[model samples]
Target: MDFERTNPIERDAYKNFDDSSELQSDIRFDQVETRLLRQQQDDEYLQCLREDQEREQRKTQKLLDIEKLLANLCLDEEEHQKKKEEFVKMKEPMLLAIEEELSKLCLEKHERDRQKEQLDKMRKEKAPRIPVEPPAGLPELAHLAIRLPNGERIMRRFRHTDKLKDVFDFIFCYPNAPDWFDISVPLPRRDLHCEGSTVSLLEAGLVGKHALIPKRLRLTTDTTALTLRTTPSEEGLDNRRDAC
Candidate 1:
């Protein structure tokens, strides 16, 4: 009965409380807006740091790539040097065989010169024509075997080329020809590794020179075409020191 009688005063107090609460809520919204703005600015800084970290990783990866490339280049250089050394080693035996042959030829020429001198002096004296006799094989020359210098035979044999007459007259004819004749031969048509192979050229040129019997089945270059050349087989050439 009291609430009903004082209901208008109670309604007025309630309306005043509701208005104050709404005002307080508006103030709280303002404070939250300020805090959110600051947090967004902090997040921007974190994002920048993440980007920098990613960029550093990219730089590190690039440096590693460059290092790998450098390593590969070094490896290639080492391989090239190794190949050069191998080529020099392969050439040594062939050179020695050539030099030995040259020494033998020189001694023969010296003996020939001495013989000519004796003959000329005898002719100047007007002596009666004596029956010409073959000189006994100079014991020294007899010792010199064509198959091998040290009297050891090898598996392969080499002969001079017919077209090599000009080569002999031109290149090997030099004073060193008897000493350092490195005869280049032609490769066979069917031989593998003919390109830059000395043995191929030697086999072809020799077969063409009547040094070796030419057989359809034998390893031979096309003498007519005269293609590639390669180094001679090491052990074989070492045995045939006279082939040069």
Candidate 2:
């Protein structure tokens, strides 16, 4: 008991040293916890920044792809237009040649049509006149005495309603008839055959008694005069007179 009382100072010193060591240990532990929290925050921020950068890179790559596609489309369109122009140029001469040939064919066809028309007109002019029959049951008759180019005379009888073409046919069948001839009345100087074959004998005022003089056309220098003969019954002694 006396020894313990005498060492009180030493015991108090040891107690103070232990309290100081415990306080130091608590401060160190707090510092370590703070440092660990700050490090975790920094790591999270860095991860977010890396993610943002990756998104921006992907967006930039997409824009580049779109631009490349547009450029390729423009190039293809230009090439197509150039090919179309070349094709038109290649066909130009052939199209013009076809049009020219068509025009030439049209002109040739027109010329052929004109030549055919001329030929038809010439044929109509050279063709003989067609005869038409007279109306039946007519009592009146026309007596015609025709004088030939050689001063010979022939006589024939026809109905008043008969066409002048009938008289022309009768003369055309004669043995001594000229190849081409014209018949005329002397007093009035009216051409009968050249007027029209459709004219009736009554319309020409040749109903009763009439006389005609024939003039022959000479086709060559050696042409002969037309001569005609008639039977005694058909021959008339009537004097020549203009019926019209």
Candidate 3:
């Protein structure tokens, strides 16, 4: 009924207004849908950021643990080196002392061996000759006290007819006697220099008429050689001679 009374222009205007209102409603609905879609995309991006942050935290913690383990290993290595150094220092002096003791023992053993060899040689040379009766008619056995280089006094009885060389032979035949030597009379203070083969004890003045009193004879080793003899005063002290 209202459409019949209205003019064509007015109806046309009302229809256009209704169409405009429907179009506005449609635009508003589309705007709301777009806004909701944008909100969902933003939420997903925030979740992704949170996941990345958590992964980064875990990686950082693992790196820190590795660093701590490395630091502990370095400390242990340093301690081991210090202990090795200490062991070396403690062992050096002990090794040196042991070496020194071994050397001393070897030297002592060598000295003992040398002394034993010398003693053995002396025993094999027919040592300690016994006294025996002499041939008759030679001035009833003259007794004499012979002093050796080692301060040992040897007592022997000899015949006046025996050569002076006999006394020298008996004394020099003893063990540990020198290669060359000289004999001197102590009481008369005279050196005996008689020829060994020709001179007799009576000619050399070594024996007396008495039998009980023993004459003292000094035996000295020739220091350098038999050819070289210094003054009689310096013979016993300065030269490499041994005197009794």
Candidate 2 per-residue C-alpha lDDT over 1-244 given as tens digits, one digit per residue, 9 for 90 to 100: 3546658887778778889998996566445434443554466568668979998998799678656644544347688677556656756875897799899989867765664454344334433443333444457888676665444567777887777766765665454554345676643446665336667888877776566655454332321221111111122112211111
**How much is the lDDT of residue 231 in candidate 2?**
13
State the RMSD for candidate 1. 45.9
Candidate 2: pairs in clash: none
After superposition, candidate 2 runs with Cα above 4 Å error: 1-138, 219-244
Candidate 1: tens digits of C-alpha lDDT, residues 1-244:
3545667879777778889997886566445434443454466568668879998998799678656644544347688677556656756875797799799889867765664454345333322321222244322111101111122211222232222222222221122222122232112223223233333324343332111111111123342222122221111111111221
Candidate 3 lDDT trough over 10 residues, lowest sum: 230-239
Better of 1 and 3 by lDDT: 3
Judged by lDDT relative to the true structure, which candidate is superior, 1 or 2? 2
Which stretches of model 1 miss by more than 4 angstroms? 1-19, 31-35, 73-244
Clashing pairs in 3: none
Q: Is candidate 2 or candidate 3 better by lDDT?
A: 2
- Which candidate number maximizes lDDT? 2
- Candidate 2 versus the native: TM-score? 0.33
